[model samples]
Target: MVERGEPVRLCLHIGMPKTGTSLIQSVLQGLRPQLAHEGVWLPPNNLAAHRIAVEAFAADSRLSTRADVEAIREAITFEEAVAHSRPTSEEFTKVILSSEYFQQCSVPLLLPLLEKMGFSSEATSVVAALRRQDRILVSGFNQDVKAMHRSTPLIWDPDDAHQLDWYALLTPWAETFGKDAIKVQVFDREVAKKESLTCLFLEACDVSYDEASVTSLEVSRRDQENASLPADLLAFKFVANGVTRPGEVDWLIDEAQARGVGGGVYGLAEETVQAILEHYRMSNRQVALEYLGEDGDLFDDVVTAPTHTDLTVDPVILSSLLAICVAAQPRAEGARNHHLR
Candidate 1:
């Protein structure tokens, strides 16, 4: 908790997406009780990452509806927490709000919201965890497919839609939150050193975990959620996506997982990977000098080459998709009849 006269520090972690965010959030949630004892509040009732709260407040066709906003009872603004943090709170010295949506948000849209919430620029900080542009693109495309957003495969046209510009993304935040208040950590580098992205995130927020109790929290590769589908099935999934309902995608994903093909499966060529990074080369350099204060590149220029350019699917999975279609035909007809009635 803050002393007799200290402003509670507010930390906003704007996720750039597809950068192990789900995994990071999972770790923080697992250690929530320990963090609470240390005066670090993640909020009770599984509100740590706070996606719904963030979605409710900032409008860019904001995700949450008015009903959702009201249902949460104004947790979007952290009303009670903000009020309690005034002068001093015997409760918490720091508050963290995180969401991938914030990364897509602009300063003009967000500044007013923060001011209304009683957090000043001086007491607030922004933390961004970045991954390689090419990696993010590939991983994100897979996620989109898994979610049944579309059936089309990723087209290799850098000009059509490009990778994220780190400089463009962070410079605004740095200018608004102060250069010192903006914390940038390379996701690839940190993952290489430590097993837990959560620990790295908390460290960026200035929360110590060395002495904390984490006997209950566990992390293993097996349990990491939102993993990309196996690379070999990319083409098969693209085809199945055309015929399957959105909800059916989960069953397909579960079957893929059961096969244990694992995620981070390569789905792009080495040349495509290089081209994607090249598109963002200069912007990344500016971010390195300005945000990270480093003279070198923002991330290591490395590419994991795809195993095969020609797409192939396991016969078993292909057969399963056929069976699913066959099984659904009667259900579809029955639903049509019901609708007609």
Candidate 2:
């Protein structure tokens, strides 16, 4: 239990997505009751409050249209009400909030929401798991391809500049919360040897673990919360996204999953991967030296060449995706006809 006079600590895990965030969130959510018993409070009302908070902040921007602002304001009001109603029990020593969207948020945008949520800058400890740039780009691209509203083709041109700039992303948080208040962990397999991402996150939250605790927190091997699609399936989905409605595309993805279409992670060209790594090399090194106090490279290994298999869509998978598009044609035609009328 928290001492009567001390302020509550907030463990804010702002994710750099594709760094096993979903897995961590799922495990934390599952272990909420246990955590509460141990004086760690996970928000009961909103399991994913940070995501909604970030979205609201984005929509509330002046650059957004009035309708968007109003809608987001309504959402913010609802979330604020929920947060206020939550128990302010003194038994709780810490609060845990995790969301990948928070990584995209600026200090001005994020700080206000944290204040509203009853977390002070002085008491909050921000944690971010950083992945290597080349790998992150591929994962981020796959995510975009899988998204409903994303329509642009994925490109790796030097001019296009990927947003996996760790230095820029971390600076605001570090400056606001103090360098020591922000903990940076490398999201690599070798780094997390013996312990899983779930375990590493729980450790960061100051949660103790025994054999029984480990057993209780372990997610099943079969469960894939936000697993990336195979190269072939990803390619098919990328092309199919252009023609099909979001709903149809979702069904197609489910069907592909049902058919066991996954092989391994999608790969980018070697030259493209090298170019991206070189782009962020200095920034990554700076982050490591300043935040982590490591003189060596931030990444466990450099991307000298492409690591995964080529992005070749299997013939059978391509045919299946084409069929999905064909099936959606009637609905598309009906919508077009209605618009004409």
Candidate 3:
């Protein structure tokens, strides 16, 4: 929120995916009404995260034409009175636009689009949360398998290793919006739980609020945003993906999330883990020095590479999981739930 006679602040929480994005989006989305009362607004893209903004921007970023910009506008702006409401420039002291894919906005389209949306560059800042590469990769792969509607088993591709390069990831944002405009937070699950991610996000944005109340605010995670399946269930779902319709498979995905059956997305040997980490070590270090003002490693948690070679679930867990799948309600083909939105 802005002070009297000061510019209204705009905070764009672009994501480096899988770094508690769901939880962050969930918390902010849950707090939208409360935040609105305080003169800080998070606009809705179909009632939750504004992921379409980045997709729209990326579309224009590709073609670099005036028509592409209009296409971007057409993609994100809803003229229907019954659709999502946006605050007028005078309505709010501060505004937050968020989407995990926003980190990918490199071209000039984003800033000009925001200008059209009534946010000036001087009042805008970019906020991001970065996860350790190895963990995010595994989690990202699990998500791709679960929701990407993979016709074949989704395997983590080596090509995606470039995604682990934090330096490369953030550089475009810095170039597009000056380095000083970027605010970075290193993702720590333990710390986030201890001090709610919502509060952490507010702290990052310099938004004022009652921390206790903000932390206490609760929302249902029924859509199971970014929930991962345990290796066994993941394997079951992966196999089923080969044979079943995407909708038919949703029942197991939903059930697995509800029961909290989650584990390592992939069993990695120590050598493999070390290889992945070592590959991106420098990129992360650059980010630490350039953005976080820290020295050495960007992440400090102890790395535990799963040592088990067997992918099979214990018989009992497998049986229970299968039974739940059998008894679970099937969604109509092509149906998807967006309870959080």
lDDT order, best first, reads 2, 1, 3
Model 1, residue 325: distance off in Å is 9.5
Task: List the candidate 1 regions with Cα displacement exceeding 4 Å.
Answer: 1-4, 45-89, 160-163, 211-224, 261-264, 310-316, 320-341
Error of 3 at 52 (Å): 5.2
Once model 3 is optimally superposed onto the true structure by TM-score, how far is the C-alpha of residue 197 displaced, in angstroms?
Answer: 1.1
Query: What overall lDDT goes with each candidate model?
Result: 0.67, 0.70, 0.65
Comparing 1 with 3 on TM-score, the higher-scoring candidate is 1
Quote the lDDT for 173 in model 3. 71
Give the TM-score of each candidate: 0.78, 0.80, 0.78
The regions of model 2 sitting more than 4 angstroms off are 1-4, 45-48, 55-87, 159-162, 189-194, 211-216, 221-224, 262-265, 302-314, 319-341
Q: Report residue 26 deviation for candidate 3 (angstroms).
A: 2.4
Cα lDDT, model 3, residue 160: 71
Which portions of model 3 miss their true places by more than 4 Å? 1-7, 44-52, 55-86, 89-91, 151-160, 189-193, 218-225, 256-265, 307-341
Angstrom error of the Cα, residue 187, model 1: value is: 0.9
Clashes of each: 0, 0, 0
Residue clash pairs of candidate 1: none
Candidate 1: residue 67 lDDT (0-100): 42
Stretch of 10 with least lDDT, candidate 2: 63-72
Better of 1 and 3 by lDDT: 1
- Residue-by-residue lDDT tens digits, candidate 3, 122-146: 7778888888776776677667667
